[model samples]
Target: MMVSYVLVMVIIIKGYGKRIGEYIDEECRREIEKKWERWEEKKRREEEEGVREEMELWREESRRRIGEMKERMEEGIRRRIREKIREKKEEIEKIEGRLELEEEEIGEIELEEEGIEEKLRI
Candidate 1:
């Protein structure tokens, strides 16, 4: 009778131990899954930050290029204006003495020179 009782106890212990082991394995799996989720979140945030920084750098470079282009355009305009002024001065000088000019025409030429000088100031 005692041997029978011992055998029943052994069977009960095996059944409950297997259930406990399964419970422990489930908890471990849950913890591992949670950690994986956190790691993925961190990785995603870092990638977004990297992309934002790259865009900022690109914007700065674009602004610099635009500024340089504007400077070049302004310089070209100024150069063209100067060349026109010089050519007009040469033409006026040729007309002043080489022709029989009226006083009014000479005055008009002087006024034209003054206007050209004003444009140069700008």
Candidate 2:
């Protein structure tokens, strides 16, 4: 009788084991798919965040380059203005020197005329 009972239980387990295994396999596949979807979503969010950070860094670099260019341009203009001022000062000095030379020549001519007139009177 015990042998018969064991044989009956073995038959029952064999009948149901394949169906249980199939059910368990389907459940495991669904769980793995769910986990994969979550992982993909997380990776996409991380990539988007990285892109945002890259864009921000690019903007900052552009702003810094623009500021540097503006400063260099301003410095160049200042240097040019200083050079022009120096050139103008040099021109003014040359004109003043020429005027002094002309005055001295005119004074010498006047003295020579006076001396000739005195000699004629003697």
Candidate 3:
């Protein structure tokens, strides 16, 4: 009877030890899963931040290019306007020169006619 009691007690102790070991293993698994989840969350946040930074950089580049293009277009327009004004000024000068020459010829003709009239009166 004593031997039987001892055997039963040994079996109960072994069962209790197995239960404890299993609980420890389950707790370890849960802890590892929690750590993995935290790591995944951190990685995801970093990726999102990187993507946001890239987008902002691209936006800035695009804005800069647009500004440069606008400036170039404005400069070209100003240059064209200046060229047109210069051409118009040159044309005006040419017209004024021709008018001056015609006036000088008219004055010469008037003097010749006055001389001819004086001779006729004499």
* Highest TM-score against the true fold, candidate: 2
lDDT, candidate 1, equals: 0.93
| Stretches of model 3 off by over 4 angstroms after superposition | 1-26, 112-122
Against the true structure, what is every candidate's RMSD? Answer: 14.3, 3.4, 3.8
Candidate 2: tens digits of C-alpha lDDT, residues 1-122: 99999999899889988998999999999999999999999999999999999999999999999999999999999999999999999999999999999999999998999999999999
| Candidate number that wins on lDDT, 1 or 2 | 2
Candidate 1 segments exceeding 4 Å error: 1-13, 100-122
Q: What is candidate 1's lDDT per residue for 69-117, written digit by digit as tens?
A: 9999999999999999999999989888566566777788989999999
TM-score of each: 0.65, 0.71, 0.69
**Full ranking by lDDT:** 2, 3, 1
By lDDT, the best candidate is 2
Give the runs in model 2 whose Cα sits over 4 Å from its true position: 1-12, 110-122
**Which is the better candidate, 2 or 3, if ranked by TM-score?**
2
